[model samples]
Structure formats: C-alpha cells, structure tokens
Target chain A: MNNLVEIVNLTKKYGSNVAVNNLTVSLPKGKIIGLLGPNGSGKTTLIKMLNGLLTPTEGTIMIDGNYVGPATKSKVAYLPDRTYLTMNQTIREILDYFQDFYADFSRERAEEMLKSLGIDPSVKMRTLSKGTKEKVQLILVMSRDASLYILDEPIAGVDPAARDYILRTIINNYNPEATVLISTHLIEDVEQVLDEVIFMRYGQLVLYTSVDNIREEKGKSVDAYFREVFAC
Target chain B: MLGKLMKYEWKNTWKAGMLMLLGIFIVTVAGCIVLQMPGGVVSNLVDGNEANAAQTWLVISSFTATLILYVIMLLASTWGMLIFLGIRFYRSMYTDEGYLSHTLPVTANQLFLSKVLVSGVWYLFIMIGIGISIVALLVSLMMGLMDISELSGVLTQYNGNVWEFLGDGIYELNRVYEEQMGMNLLHYGITLLLTYVAGPFITMITLFGALTIGQLSSKHKGLIGILAYAGLTILSSIIGSTVQSVFMFSTNIVSSAGGTGITTNWAYDINVLTSALVAAIMYGVSYYIMNRKLNLD
Candidate 1:
C-alpha cells in the first residue's frame, strides 16, 4: 500500500507547551487505522494539522505526495469534532455545498443515506437534534469518495446506537483504495473495526501495530493492551 | 473556485444585505408619504394665524416624527451594511464554521479575494440604494413645499434638453475647477468616487488581518483581534496623514507651476492613490496571515 499521509518531526506548540512534540508517523492507503489516545494526547491536533486548520509550529506534513494545501484538501475529507455546518443552512443546501466544493462528493449516496436515516433535506441544522446533526455531518463526510478520510472523535458524544451506526456507515462507505484515520479515546467501541492501531501518548507515537499482532503477541485484546501500555 | 466561493459568499450574505436595503427603502417611502400628507409642510406665511395653530402643530409634529425615523434608518442602513458584512466574515472564517471554510479546496488568496469582492459589491449596492432613497425623499419634500405649477414652470426652462443643460452646467463646473485647482471636475469626481469605494475594502481587509493576528492567541482571540484593529487603525491614520501632507506640499508646487493641467489635480489623485495603496497593503497582510499563520481554534 502506498503512503497516503506522511509526517516528519511534526511539532505543534502553544506558547512554551508542545501539543504535538517532534512526532513522525505515516499512514498507508487501503486501511482502517485507529489513532488512539487518551484526553489531551494530540489526536485532534494531528488531525487538524492534516486538514490544514492549524499550522504546525515546526516540521512538515505531506498528504498524497503533496504538502498540506488546497490540493491535499481536495483529496482529504475531514470531520472536525465540532459542528462545523452553519445552523442557518438547510440539509439540501449543505449537500449542495459539498457537491460544489468536492469533485468526488456523491450526492446520490448522500441522499440515500439521508433517506435511510429518515432525515428531511429541507430541515435547517438548528432544528436537528445533536445526534441527528452528527449523523448528518458524518453522512456528508462519508459521502465523499475521497482518497483519505480523517475523522476526529466521530463517536465521542453520541449514544451507543448512533456510534454503531456511524461506525457502520464509515465501514460501508469508504473506498478500498482509500485510508480512514479515526481518532478517539473509546478504544473498545472501535477496536473491532480497526485493522491497524497507532497508540499516542503525550504527543508521541508509543506503538504502531496491527490489532491481530497485539492480540497474538500479548494474548489480550487491543483495549486491554492499551490499558496496560498507557496505565497511569 | 474563486468564482464559486464568491457565489456562495453572496448567497450567504444577500439575505441580510437585501433586508438592510429593504429597510432603507421602506423608511424612505414612509418619509415620502409623510411629506405628501395633507398639511404636512410648515408654511411661514400661516405661522401666526390663530385659526391654523392646530394644523400647523400637526404638520410640525409629522415632520419631526418623519425626520427622526429617517435619520435612524439612515444610520442603521449605513452601519448595518458594514456591521453585517464584518460579522459574516468573522463568523464564516474565524468561528467554528471556519473548520469547513478553511478546509475547502480553495487557496487562501482565493478566499480572501472572494470575500473582499463580495463585500465591496454589497457596500456599493447599499450606497446606491441609500442615495436613491435620499433623492426620492428630497423630491417628495420639494413637491410638498412648492406648487406643482411653479415647479413645472421651472422645468419648462429645460425644454426636454435636460442632458444638454446638465452638460453645459458640467462644463462650467469643470472650467471653475480648472481655474482654481488646475484639474477637470470630471476626473476629480471619478477619483473621489474611487476613494469612497476603496474605503470599505480597506476597512474589511484590515479587520481580516486583525482577526488573523488574533487567532495566534490561545484565549481571548476576539479581544486580541479588537486590539489589533485599534492598532492598525491608528497606524493607517498616521500613515494616511503623512502621505496626504507630503502630496499636498508637492502638489502645491505643481499648482504654482500651472503647467501640468489635469494631472496636477493632486488632491483627489493623492486621495485615490494613497487609499488604493493602503487597501492593497491590508490585503497583503491578510493574505499572508491567512496563508501562512492561520490558527483557527
């Protein structure tokens, strides 16, 4: 598998504190990679840097052989932890926005998902429940047949049912050649779907291996291994 | 992509823009209607007549109310246009929506330019709308103050050659400007108009630059942005005054020479050139910050 993302000595600092400290990592295509970390471990920062929302204080990030920029943005589909959609916009208008901006955006797929979820296209974002809004955002993000999908805590605040649906939607919609990087602290919930797991601790990559290897080598699930590795 | 960005920008802002314009229109029309009301105008000749006191009082009260409403609407429209544009730019580019905005497949320059262009267009539109409304109100007021027959008598002098009459008036005005300022009034007028149009762009871009600078802070970004705005405003003011004085001094020398003709009209020319340069600098700073140092939280 070709490298979909490459980061070299990436360091993001706030004042005297480092958020992502001299971290180097790479993600290859055709995989569901879990970017697992506890709270304040820089998972969101790394995802934001990949999407070009935050500039790295030092070092560089390359996405698909190009520097993080508009070109990379075109290929990378990002779901920030916050609700980035405008509250004033209708679901259909938001869909149109995605269609207009992303060349790979699939309106048909988005409409099908909305139909399955029983979401009205004309409803404004403010009228939707928090769970529904997350579902809509996830639908829009997944609707794009992007080269890389970067999801930041997609199931953090949602109920278990919604989490299951989100994970299912993510697994069902992604292209085989594309890579999915999901960042979350809920190790057990997403452990079943992850092919490879990268554990981050205090802005550092502590472990990078397949879930099968962790289970085979330690005779424990990835979640249990995570508990042992990152135990305070 | 810039075009598409501008299209979306216009879509986002047009609702509020149109509402402001509509507010101005409604206020102006109401003013006009009030002026045309029976006994709405004050008459100097009828002022001291005891029998007409009630009528005069009613007319004076009507005029006062209409004037107050018109003034409020005027202030609202002007400030509303600018404030609404600023809010749109800040919310769309700096708030949580910024996650989507900055992640779009568009360059920083493209985003900045699209915003500037859309803002400029809206400013111009609102200005034109306000101007038309003011003119209509004035016409209505004139109709209320003067007799229609007398007004028609004055209009008969134009004899359906209003354009030629206006041209002659303009030529005379140009001759006067040529004598006093060594420049054509038409050229000076164009420069003044350009200066006016450049104002909103400079203001908007400066705010953008300030917001970008503010984003560098982890907390109280809005406060930082406000401070940056205050600092930039003062800096620009000092720079503008210096440039103006320098141009005024040099242009005095040319004015004394009396040889450069239209080109020597340094007053409006300096204003236009200096304004364009300032706006360009603001745009440059905004583009740099947006491209290199964007730190949306």
Candidate 2:
C-alpha cells in the first residue's frame, strides 16, 4: 500500500526548543491510525505542519503525494483542538460554509449526522455546550470525502459517552479508501477502533506498528503496551 | 473563489455595517424633521424682530441641538465604516477563527485581495450614503431658513434647480481663486476627489501591515500594532512635509527668478504623486507580510 502521508526530516523549532525534532514517518492509506502521546509531545505541532497551519522550520510534509499547500489542503480534512467556528453562526451556516469551501464535503452526510445526533441545525454555536460543539466539528470533518482526515485531540476534554459517540461517528463516516490520523492520549478508548498506532515521546516517534502485531507479540492490549513504554 | 470569499465576508460584516448606515439615515431624517419645524419658527421670529429672550433662547438651543446631531451622524457614518471594516479583518484573520481561515483551500494572496476588495466597496458605499444624507439635510435647512417670498425669488433666479445654483456658485469661486492665487480650482477639486477616494484604501492597507507586524510578537500584540501604526503615520507625515517644503522653496525661487509661465500646479501634482507613492508602498508591504510572513496565532 502506498503511504498517504510522508514526513521527511521534519523539525519544528520555536526559538531554542524543538517541538518536533528531525522526525521521519510515513502513514499508509486506508487505516485509522492513533497518534498517541502525552501533552506537549509535538503531536499537535506535527498535525499543524501537515495541515500547513505552521510552516515546517526544517523539512517537508507530503500529503497524498503533494506538498502541503492549497492542493494538499483540499485533500486533507482538519479538525483543530478548539472550536474554530464563528460563535454567532448556526450549525446550518457552518455546514454551508464547509460545503462551499471544500469540494469533497457532503452536505447530505452532514445533515444526516446532525439528525442522528439530535442536534438542532438552527442552534447557534455559542449556545451549544463544549462537548456538543466538539461533536459538531467532528461531524463536519467526518462528512468530507477527502483523501486524509487529520483530527487533533478529537476525543479529549469530553465525557466518556460523548467520546464514544465521536469514535463511532469517525468509524461510520470515513471512506474505505481514505486514511484517518487521530491525535489523542486516550489510547484505551481509541485502541479498539484503531487498526494501527504511532507513539511519540518528547518530539520523537517511538513506535509505529499494527494493533494486531502489538497484541500478538506482547500478549497484551495496545493500551498496556503504551503504559509500559511511556512509563517514567 | 474571490467572489465566494467576499460573499462570506459580506455576510459576516453586513449586519454591523448596515446598522451603522441605518443609524446615520435615521439621525439625519429625524434631525431634518426637527430642524424644519423649529427652524422655520426661529427664522420667522427673528425676521419679524418680535421674539422675546426666552423664545430666542429656545429656538437657538433647538437649532443647536439639531446641528450637533447632524454633525455627529455625519462623522459617525464616515469613521464607522473604516472602524467596522478594520475590526472585521482583525477578528476574522487573527483570532481563533484564523485556524479555519488559513486552512481553507485558498492562497493567502486570494484571501488578502478578497478582503481589500470587500473593504474598498463598502467604504465607497458609506461615502456615497453619507453624501446623500448631507444633501438631504442641507435641503431641509434651506427650506426652513428661507421665507416664502425669498424662497420663490431664489427658486426662480436659479431656474428651479438648486444643483445648477450650486454649480454656478462653485464656478464663481473657482474663477475668483484662479484670478487671485494663480491656482486652477478645478484641478484642485479633481486632486481632492482622487485623494479622498484613494485615502481609505491606503489607510486600510497600512493598518493591515501594522497588524501583520504586531502578529510577529506573541505578547501585547494589539498595543504593539497600534504603536506601529502611530510610528508609521508620524514618519510618513514628517517625510511628506519635508518634501512639500523643499518643493515649495524651489518653486518660489524659480518663479521669482522669472519663470512666469510655470504654474504652481506642480505642487499639487507632486502632492498627489506623493500620496499615490505612499499608498503603493503600504500596499506592497501589506501584501508581503500577508503572503510571506503570516503569523496567525
């Protein structure tokens, strides 16, 4: 299988401190990969660089065989860690905006998801709770038929039940030919849904292997292996 | 793509912009109505020379209040457009919303051009709206101040078209200025018009540049942006004044040394050229920062 994302000598520095230091990794297509790391382990920075929000200080990120720019942006669906939607806009307006901007976005799928979630399309974003807002953002990202989905902390800072809904939405909505890169620290919650895992520790990728391989080799859940590897 | 971007930009800013415009219209209309009634009474009393002190005071106060309201509305209509557009740019491009804005499938140049075009259109709209409101207010005041006989006489003298009367008045003034100061008032009028139209574009782009500079720093960015703008303004003003003085001095020396045919229109030409030059520099700097050094935090 060809890789959907390739990072070559990627090093992002703030001033003196390196956020992502000379990291190299490639993510194959058509799998849900969990990017597991603790806080400040450079997960978000890597995702931002892939999405072209932050220019790489040292190297290049290729998405779907194209360098990160407007072309790559069209193929990558990104869900940032925060609520980036305008507070005054309604759910319907945001969906319309996504549909207008992203040619791969499916308004029908978004509406169906909103209906399944029992979310009011006319409700303003500011009136929604933080968890609901996060869910809305996830639904929008998942409705896109892009080549890659890069979601940053999609399951963090929400209730366990909301987290389950988000995971289910991701599982149901992603296309079979596309890849989804989800960044989060809740390994146990996401392990069952992920086919592969990539672990980063202190701005370096420490592990990248299939979940089945890890389970077969270690005789334990991927979460247990994560706990063992990241233990201080 | 630029059109679509501007459509959404208009969607986000139209509420505030329209409300400000509506406020100007309402204030102008209300002032005109109040002035028409009170102004007639006050002028009639004064013309008859029969009003007591109390009545005079009441008329004066009423007229003054209406005048103040008209002035305030006029000022608000003009300044509010620029302020509102600037706020829209800052909020949409720099705040948390920037995450989506920058990630959209559009290049930075397209985004910048869309914003500049939208802002420019809205500025022109506000200027024209204000111009119409002022004309309406003046017409009302004229109607209120003139007695029936004087109004008829003036109406007949101007062939019943106030615009023609105003045009003739301007023509006379232009001729007087031409005779006295060797300045073609028509040329001055054209220069002023061009400057007025170009000034807002330059100002908006300069603000964008300062905002971009401020974004380079992570702390106290707003204050830094304001200070940067102030510094730019002061530096440009000093340079402009120095150039103007040098031009003036040289022109005076040459004219006194017997260059009679050479007109002082060079001064205004240079003035307009200098403004266009500054605007171009500001636009270039703004485009550079937006395209290359966009630090949207």
**Model 2 DockQ vs. reference:** 0.63
Model 2 alpha-carbon drift over 4 Å, by segment = B34-50, B142-168, B260-279
Clashing pairs in 1: none
Worst 10 residues of 1 chain B by lDDT: B40-49
> What tens digits encode model 2's per-residue C-alpha lDDT throughout A75-168?
9999998889999999999988998999999999999989988999999999999999999999999999989999998998999999999999
How far does residue A87 in candidate 2 sit from its true spot (Å)?
1.4
DockQ of each model against the real complex?
Answer: 0.88, 0.63
Minimal lDDT window, size 10, model 1 chain A: A12-21
For each candidate in turn, the interface RMSD (Å) is 0.5, 1.4
lDDT of 2 at B210: 71
Count backbone overlaps in model 2: 0
Name model 1 segments beyond 4 Å from true. Answer: B36-51, B146-160, B178-183, B234-238, B245-264
